[model samples]
Target: MKRFCKVRWIALLLLIVAGTAFLSFKNSDNRSFQLAKNIDIFSSIVKELDLLYVDTIDANKTIREGIDAMLYSLDPYTAYYPEDDQSELEQMLKNTYGGIGSIITWNTKLKRSMIGEPYEGMPAAKAGLKAGDILMAIDGQDLEGKNNQEISEMLRGQAGTSFKLTVQRPGVEKPLEFELVRRAIELPIIPYYTKLENNVGYINLSTFSGKPAREFKQAFLDLKKQGITSLVIDLRNNGGGLLDEAVDIANYFLPRGKTLVTTRGKIEQINMSYKTLREPIDLDIPLAVLVNSSTASASEILAGSLQDLDRAVIVGTRTYGKGLVQTTRSLPYGGQMKITTSKYYIPSGRCVQAIDYKHRNADGSVGRIPDSLTTVFHTAAGREVRDGGGVTPDIQVEQEKLPNILFYLVNDNLIFDYATQYCLKHETIADAQHFELTDADYADFKEMVRKADFKYDQQTEKILKSLKEMAEFEGYLKDASGEFEALEKKLQHNLDHDLDYFAKDIRNMISIEILKRYYYQKGSIIQQLKDDPDLKEALKVLGDTEKYHSLLSPKATADPAVAEK
Candidate 1:
């Protein structure tokens, strides 16, 4: 019976394929004939390779490789997803996944996996797991020698599954046992929202997913009740998600029936305009959106739409320009492909697609739209905007780069180690917003980092090395030897001096790391705003009613970049 069923299945597949070829042949169009011919050739080549190849071939893998190669000719966003990766993709966009709901990090020096952070109300947090807890083992397997990926795999499973964890929290006498039942954890699209001074509300929309507009509505309404007349929707580093969600979020500020975006494609059926479907939450609220280079796609749609409609003042750096739309099509055997199907245009009739991927240079390198090619578009209030790239900011705020010395300490886990030590000694710390590293605390931190065996090669040393190589190549090494030796001596970085020189920035970093130990992500969020220059500029703009209204009106003077990060 099994053999008969297999034969029947094969027969059905062959009949369907034959019918498709017959239809293509009957039509006799060049495209259909070419497609049919290529498919036949592909089938023949695969059959021959499987039967006559020198080495053993995995048929499924070979076919997948062919599919990937075929898709590689398209844009980067068009991708093939195998059967196994389907679930992961679904979980990422939908925000529903069965896992331990905690993030872990592997310390190469310590050789232990430690909890970096945990989602609130998740299995890991509910099981009494804290930020600094060390995972000794899972089930019967020891986790000490395992990397983050291996340990993470052990913690994930289908919902309703049980797992045993051995966690060693700092200051605890012994390892604590936890029996946790994994469940579907749904993370919020808007992770952080707070009220700032002068009655400004800050809402961070990390991604357009899982009813983000609804979430933003609630957050806005709640803040309105708290007397907030101004809002800052931070889309910095938001890579974006669903397009409809972007429309919905834009609708929160736009009036009903206002055209939000229009998508055009090869197919007339897909070419359509999306508009605000409901009454706006508050049209008169002073709105500013914070965007960075990573803010893209649907995030761009929301930001660009709002900007084109003159609903929100765009702040921060220019956004990530991605105006193309993608649609995922299911393939056979549970596989899928995400194909770029359309380009989205905002209210100003501008497609902010920066890269011209379809057109390549002589050397096959993709080209970006040149400055001369950028077209100008006008907003609803007649404010000048440009196309062929991202949404330009009305005001730009530059972020400070971490000094190399501070960067080295942070990257080498020295800061993490010191924060762990500080938490061990101190029972508690002040609120995140109020927390500040004192002079004596920095002194202690300097000492701790000194002993942490941190080292960094200076940029000047690299240039010196290059100079020495050039001198040697030119046979002038002996003449410059003495000068090179003196320069090397002069360039030798003194740890104590460097630490003192970059004290404020280093201290802020240490303060944040320390906050993470006590308050987790909640603390980090609050503490980040304490020194946020962008937030300061946003508040300044919103607080100054004259500047705010002028920015929205036609022929208004745009603020030059106050500071480049």
Candidate 2:
């Protein structure tokens, strides 16, 4: 009787699956048969693998691998989130977490976990854990040779709980222990803002999460109180977040009922238009929107809308092209699926989605839409704009690529180590915008780098490697050995000479890292603004009101947007 009941249930499942396939294929018998055949084949394969093949198959891992391969054939944005990742997903939307608020790094040379910098007023800061403190143990558990991720997991916990850790300070011989009670760390969304020269306000909105528009409103009001006539909204590395906040920010410079964006999908419910519902805070204020390659999604929406209406002058590189919108659906257990639901279009009727995921290449790889496929669209002021990609700035400022050594120094924490040493000696320094390391200070830093045993590959080394590989592939490596060896010897980088050769670049980086210990993110921003090209360009344009208005106004005397080469 049990066997008969099991057979009946199996039959019911197959009937339901066949019905689903029939409906999906629009009643096409051949397609429906093909779908059933594939399902059967797949099920048989899985069953055979689970029962007969391998010593012991990990069912969950195997199933997830299959699911990942299927999803890989789709767009990058469409993804499946397991239950373990739900917290991270929630934190992205809410921007709050329970942890000992501190940035950490793994010191490869020392083979120990180290504290990078503690967020001001948080657990780590309150515990007197300074930057460069080596985390030797947490909760009496040895942290020697532990990676940053392991140390971070050890540190993070629920609010109101406590974690014990021992850190080795630079001057102190003995390890200092501290028992820090955890709390919900709410990181500042608006990290830095300042009233610049000529009363031009600057607001660097790093993320769009948890009522950022409200924070922006407060920043705007503060700037207005300071008698600022113009504003620069910097969105250089903002990878974007909540769409509602983006719409709210757009509403600040636009009137009620003005359309901001629209989303369209296969379903009717997904088709919706988002318009500004509130009156503008300041409709007449001269504004400049700054963006770069990392600016995307909600950021693109905000920048694109302003440009479409000719409300603000955009200054920076081309933005990250991302127009597809995602929505989450509850999966079985506690897992959730974040799937691409629709594609959003800005006010100019241009979809800034660059990649073509649906129509894959012959090799099943996705390719970005070619420039030839991009169509021209007219803005509200009759200015020409392009669809099928991201927003292009009115005044483009190309970022310079620093030397590979500079990157290695920063990435490998050589600069960080020197900054920590500098901090121990000096309690304070000059203001962020006006601070520069002296020649003596730079000399000490170079000595520190030498002691740290840092080795970095130069771009010339990469070229040499490629040359050697080509010579070997062409069967001439034996004959070319002498020349290759000579080339390698000639290209050898000296740590001593590199310090002075890239002195200016190294100085700027070391200054920023050192200032962070004193003033946090605000310090970094303040220091950067002193030599920021985008800010300079914005200031120049704002100073000349005629040029600023000409960029926005339909009847222009001269075009401010430099044509793309």
Candidate 3:
């Protein structure tokens, strides 16, 4: 029995030695061998410490943290998500979860989580949550110092559960609380759609969801029934969703059997082409696609496919360049890892991937794609198109930045607070499209601002005081220190004068907020459309059939400089 026990121990030792040898051999290969070697050594050390240490240690936690840190070294996207992170991952990919459906951003000036936007028909919107209302706490927990994700997680739960929100508006000294019920927040794929004119239809597709393709088909058919001959598909800040959905959407506009996109990868099966399978809903309809820098992945696929077929004229900014395809691998403990499995190529035979992370400069910056690396491709009308960074627009539209005064007004919650107070005082307002802040209402708002203490960060006052002290000590401003103090006081008085300069911008913001209170998301969008240059451009493109065709046709030889040269 003693001999058998000794032999068993020897066998176990031999197995351990063999395993270590095999791992070491594997680590001594490839460019990332050093990284693997460090991980191996760290693992070995951790095992040894856990087994032989005088105190107990959490092996799983240590390993998880180490893995997280290691992945963080690669890039922001490359992450280690454990079993606990699976739900969050699902929320991002599928874009559905139980929560109070509203988008919130931290107002740095106000130091509160202000509602930036709300999805139409969402629980938050339905519960009377408007943009700019500060979320002080959730279910009695103060949400200060939490990130967007953290706040989202806290707000989300099993459907039908209730959560209370403590909110503080601008003028309100006391915090108001509301009991909100958590529900399955499945944000719709198509938020709003309408006929732009007699023969033109516009559909705002927010995501490529499970039913987006079907929804789009119905929308197109409905428009066709309503005498639609042209369409504008807005894909700004869409951020993309499912690949199959994109293909389905592409098939709705392109001819049957036309190749939409293809994927190439190390894996043989992933290297397959995606073609339109069904008859097109509208092959002859004049389609205009609106894309911006935030439009990515599946959105790019739809736009690129349409561009390749000369089916649509893409307008607005260059698209967000993301050509890599990710596939989720189910791991142990219900966790999944979404690994980059393949590179997606659009119909023009070009990859719209922006970054070449493999090639980096000495300073760790990504090097530009050289001219030699660039290649040419053609669209259906023989239009030359190059790919690498992103899809360039047929016509570029420059974005306008908000003025500083307007920025402060929104950022500081002055407008938000005024809106809340106005909502409380007034029972109703004019329709979203017709609503305008009257002169009397503006006067009342200004008066309220005068009574309220809106403290902006006073860097100028601090600097001026410091400079005055320095000047007095240096004997240069011993005489003029008084003058500097007087000047500072005069500037303080003049600070109110800038209000007139910022009034129009401030009023616009106020108008948007107030409109949202009355008309909801659709109303705000309608109001913004009055000033939206992109919509106007899209309308013009759709209105002129000849000009639209010209824009879609081959203008010049593809510029290599734009792609890689």
Residue-by-residue lDDT tens digits, candidate 3, 424-540: 777798887678888788888777777765545455667787888898788889678668868887757343665666677677778888777766667767776667777788888
On the 0 to 100 scale, the lDDT of residue 406 in model 3 is: 64
Sorted on lDDT, highest at the top, how do the candidates line up? 2, 1, 3
lDDT of 1 by residue, 37-154 (tens): 9999999999999999999899989998888777766677888888876655676468677887888876657778888778767888888787778889888787766788777777
RMSD list, candidates in order: 10.6, 9.0, 10.4
- 166-279 per-residue lDDT for model 2 (tens digits): 999988889999999988877778999989899999999988877799999999999999999999999989888899999999999998998989999989999999999998
- Provide the lDDT at 255 for model 3: 83
Candidate 1: the clashing residue pairs are 399-565
- Local accuracy by lDDT, each model: 0.84, 0.88, 0.79
Model 3: ten consecutive residues of lowest lDDT: 71-80
Off by over 4 Å in 3: 1-36, 45-66, 72-75, 104-119, 125-151, 163-180, 367-374, 440-499, 502-504, 556-565
lDDT for model 1 comes to 0.84
